[model samples]
Target: MANLDLTLKDMMAVDGAVGAAVVDYDSGMALGHLGGSKALDLQVAAAGNTEVVRAKIRTMEQLRIKEDIEDILISLSTQYHVIRPVSGRKGKGLFLYLALDRGRANLALARHRLRDIEENIEV
Candidate 1:
């Protein structure tokens, strides 16, 4: 199994991956991050996205929808933003954020790869 740091490193190696971070939605903080540029700061992105996550969860709660978030995909002209919430008791309220170059990334493959990365990444 890949450890957190190692798995994050592996994710950064994906063809289009530009930046990645493991974030805690409850706290709006990134526990770990890698490969960010001036235009995209992983920590800042993580913090901002935490609100998105929280808002979604709250909305679901209010709607009485009993479900888990698999992942949230935000597509931009130049990039693909992926938010994958970790499962299992040990990983509650945490997610993996990956930003990839749209031209270089294969969305399906990247989603599948992120699932694998999630399985192997230890808290």
Candidate 2:
């Protein structure tokens, strides 16, 4: 199984990846991070995205939606931000956040790769 550091490295290998982090949504803290440039502070982004995840979860509960979230995508003029909640039993309240250059990323493939990587994580 992949460890946290390896998982973070794998995420950085994705095309156009600008930054990545594993975060705890419950605490708005990053468990690990990589590849943040001057324009992006991954730790700060991770903490901010926790609110997005929490808000979505709350809305889903209010709407009584039984389905789990796959991933939340935010499209920006220059970037694509993907937040994927870990599905492993031990990984509840954790998520993998990825930032990609909009011109170079393939959204579908990145999602697929992230899911595969998440599955391999030992937690």
Candidate 3:
């Protein structure tokens, strides 16, 4: 299994990856982060996305949808923000967030790779 550092490094290898972070949605805190420029602060993004995840979970509960979320994709004009909640036993309440350049990223492949990274993460 990969540790947090290795997992984040792997995420950077994805095409068009601008930044990546592992966050705890419960506390809205990032456990680790890599990449990101002055304009894209990974820490702030992680906290903001925690609200997104919590809202979605509340909605699902209210609607009685028992399925788990695969990933949450927020596509912008220039960027794609992918929020993937880690499903492993050790990773409950944690998520992996990746930001990609919309024009250069292959969304499908990035999702697939993120899944792989999630599975292998040791947390």
Candidate 4:
């Protein structure tokens, strides 16, 4: 299984990847991050997405949906934010956050790649 840094690095290899991070939704903090610009701070992006994860979880609980979240997609005018919660027992309370250029990314492929990366990630 891959470690946090290696997983983040592999995520960047995806087409149109701008940044990637392994974050703790509980603390809204990044465990590791890679490939970010001055205009886009990976840490800040990671922390912000923590709220997105929490909000969705809360909503699901309130609605009594007995389902797990596969991923959350936030599409912006110029970018796509993909938040994937870790499902492994060792990875509990953590997630992988990815940012991509909307114009350059193939959303379907990116999601597939991210899922594969997550499966191999070691907490």
Top model number, TM-score:
3
lDDT of 4 by residue, 45-87 (tens): 9888998999999999999999989999999999999999999
How far does residue 65 in candidate 2 sit from its true spot (Å)? 0.3
Global lDDT scores for all candidate models: 0.90, 0.93, 0.97, 0.93
What TM-score, over all chains together, does every model reach? 0.95, 0.97, 0.98, 0.97
Clashing residue pairs in candidate 1 are none
lDDT of 1 by residue, 26-111 (tens): 99999999999999999899999998898888999999999988899999999999999988666777899999999999999999
Clashing pairs for model 3 are none
Residue 25 displacement (Å), model 4: 0.6
- The C-alpha local distance difference test score for the whole of candidate 4 amounts to 0.93
Location of the lowest summed lDDT over 10 successive residues in candidate 2: 114-123
Candidate 4 total steric clashes: 0
Ranked by lDDT, the better of candidates 2 and 3 is 3
Better of 1 and 3 by TM-score: 3
Alpha carbon lDDT of residue 104, candidate 3? 98
Q: How accurate is candidate 1 locally (lDDT)?
A: 0.90
Off by over 4 Å in 2: none
State which candidate, 1 or 2, has the greater lDDT: 2
Give stretches of model 4 more than 4 Å off. Answer: none
